[model samples]
Target: MYALEKPQNFHRGTSFSLITRNGDDRSETSDYTSEDEGTEDYRRGGYHAVRIGDTFKHGRYVVQSKLGWGHFSTVWLAWDTQKSIYVALKVQKSAQHYTEAAMDEITILKQIAEGDPEDKKCVVKLLDHFKHSGPNGQHVCMVFEYLGDNLLTLIKYSDYRGIPLHMVKEICFHILVGLDYLHRQLSIIHTDLKPENILLLSMIDPSKDPRRTGAPLILPSSKSKIVSESEVSKDAKASCSDLTKNQKKKIRKKAKRAARKCIGKEEADQDIEVSSPEASHRDDKSNGEPSEEKSRNSVGENSNNDEANDASEGSRGHKRGSRSARQKLLAEVELKCKLVDFGNACWTYKQFTSDIQTRQYRCPEVILGSKYSTSADMWSLACICFELATGDVLFDPHSGDNYDRDEVALGGRYSRDFFNRFGDLRHIRRLRFWPLNKVLKEKYEFREQDATEMADFLVQILDFVPEKRMTAAQCLNHPWISVGPRQLAPSMSENGGSDKKQETDEREAMEVRVGNMAIDGAKNGKDSKSMASPLKQ
Candidate 1:
């Protein structure tokens, strides 16, 4: 799940809600679960029932609010009393399997934190961890540095029109940096890499950020009652009550339209089901002014007509100004982000499951039941880059024949299982070959130069042969990623050559390490092509 907190003003309108979901952490009953983590899971071996004022690890971390929840764990926004700062507290379920997963995640997080002492690896940092014994059972709680919204929220803020090319390049650079660190230095593979797992460093809106807004931390109180999920939902609704009816209606319409564009038809249908009548009623009650109240205030309507007209004009100006301000904020947003949610991550030689990665980001080799390595993550990164550029998934497979729409007939250890000797899919007869460049130009209206550059960078990583896919370090040096202003590595002139020399030396060292791995794989009867070979360059 994502390790970040949603702003208090955020509402669940789009299907791409900021709620994080690890690759295989979702439970079977997730389809029918409520908006919140349901009460059904608050049993002896289930989720620890967390309250607003609850304190964990002997009052070191104080729960402020629920950040999000997944089948494996629940994340909370909490105050770190020891450090006097906000943090994300992830409380895992006490079930045996969940406990094992937590232990694995903790081990990976510790390695990451230890390796990146300067915190420049673009991965989330593990702050503190402890076991909390609750009524449910002893739960493994992990504390992480509190981050801002995920890339999904950033996409929504852009109205699903997609961000600028420069911004996309900036975000891609950061993601590749993180992936390079994981794949090269730590030998870890983030099995799941998607927009939801990448988070910005700060909130999009300054007013909503606790640090920026000088918001007071919620102190622990013995008299405070446990806040139920229903009460939390009500509180979220109340926060948006001041929005005008027309404004709320506009938001809903935009959200539904964007949801349809973002998610597949089946997922969209599920979202429609989950948006029940009771939820609509709550929205209506919260957003609409009551008729009785309007009638009672009608006595002064005539007298205040002139004042109302002036107020209306002022409101229009304020709305225009607000729109401009929001645009400015988006333009000035820091593009730096970090890779988060390592629950499904595994080392190159110690994979926990064959079924890794979410459906949209799953690679061809995995689908074909072949061997996978760090290259699988490169495929997912390519998909995410496409999504960030186009505001839609690179591959959105549906049921039946549609599921093989993006499948390519490539030679692999298990290729014969799904493909014929003549290089054709056994089950799917027909195929439409639309190259990445064509898809961008014809479908998304990308300019020729932009389409070609993007296709060049992504196609290498999206190669059917896993061993031939570009390494993260190679991708970092790609021309497409270097188009924008360099943020991760400054120029020699900007830093008096010392930092640049160090950066270059590090990149060279990583390439050498990757080359050594490739040689080792080749010696073990793998492909002759080195993973560090820059296919396009």
Candidate 2:
């Protein structure tokens, strides 16, 4: 077993913090601090400062590393002593509001777990929950089965080029099955559905997985006294006082320069669109790297120049090969995923908040302040499908002047709510109509057939009227989903079995492929319609 390092600042060395919203519509503002949850939150009624090798619940779970941190809680990768497995341990803040939110989430997760005893619902399972007492306060800690990277990570692994049509179908099948179980079986509404909320069944890269790598478990060690942020600050100040004035001046200048560089990089990155309409027009070179042509022109015809050219070409070839390998690996991945982060879920009859869903996936009904139901989730699902097929978001509305123009394109039943009698938007009179199919074909360069099929499937779910939107069960049977790799082939028995046996085997295979039990054609109901609707006006 690896010995635990000395307990220093617990917030150091963590990469980007994972921000999980608790279904609040209000925006939050914070000062730029460290990438991890700021040190200020390490106090009474705040985040519980966790250290590696620290055990919780009578040494049942040993902390290994910080997974991520959200506004309400800090998630850690822990080794379960009794279970002999790795688990995600979520330690929520001890504040009253956060505690209440944790209780609500626990209730929802319990209901989900109880409904799906076999764990076939494609939903995250809540393994255990208990109270953890620490120097900060009493925290409600939840233990969950450790899953792999989320859908957003999968998208990144694809280099934002979007997954193939067959792979997208496979992922969509799982998401729809989960949604069907939640909406049809339990009457629950997952108000917030996005790429970040869906997690793959296993890590895309097996080398990083502890279970696959046979990594030793982190064992519990002697407890160390927890240090508060205030104490750390005092110690820091004392150390600074011991330094010479000249050294302090140099340190201040270095910090200022580093801050400026950080701000400049952030602004530059914001201008670079990962997958936008203008992306095709931009050069295919990564930022901060010199172009091949530029590198060639800068070098003179010498032996050193020849070596540099060879090195550059080799590096470029290596990058290309690596990307190709990753795509191939992604194609072979199991494509199994589970819906997670239920901090905002509620029953259709009793919603926790009207302002639900991320901005990109928000339905037109929710934007127009109309009553939402299970169809709201369907709308979000449609948006996710489009994103998976074509790396760009369907609707990316901005604030102020551009908001009305971008939102009006979504067209909903509540036109009178935001539009004038003349059929013009009240806030912004000028509007531009860009049909979905046209946007996919012209802007994203999707093939005509692919664009048409994708739009037909999405438009049905994105209907202005919420009730007309396709249900998850109906989406599972959509023509677009049934085509490609998901298409069922006639069964041919190797043992030359009877015709009846072959038919039964084929039916079972179809059911397994779709990840749902109710595969009967009649179960789709009236929501399933002919694929003749045009996405373009």
lDDT of each: 0.61, 0.59
Deviating ranges (above 4 Å) for candidate 1: 1-34, 223-326, 401-417, 483-537
Top candidate when judged by lDDT against the true structure: 1
Candidate 1 lDDT score at position 446: 68
Model 2 lDDT per residue over 414-469, tens place? 56655677665555432234466655555445667766777788878878678988
Q: Tally clashing residue pairs in candidate 1.
A: 0
Question: TM-score of each candidate?
Answer: 0.66, 0.66
The CA lDDT at 360 in model 2 is 59
Q: What is the C-alpha lDDT profile of model 1 across 1-537, one tens digit per residue?
A: 101111111111111111111233222333412335556777779987665545676556665556666668777776665566778888889988989999999999999999999999899999988888765778998999888767766665654545666778889999999999999999999988877788888877666666577665555323222223334444445666789888766656655455434323322222111122222222222212101110111111111111111111000011113534655777777888999989989999999988777656777667665778999999889878877776665554432333233343344655565568787656543232445675566545566777778788988887767898899899988998865445434222211111223354564565577567657776888643211111112
- Where does candidate 2 stray beyond 4 Å? 1-34, 227-321, 400-418, 483-537
User: How well does candidate 2 score on lDDT at residue 127?
Assistant: 96
Clashing pairs in model 2? none
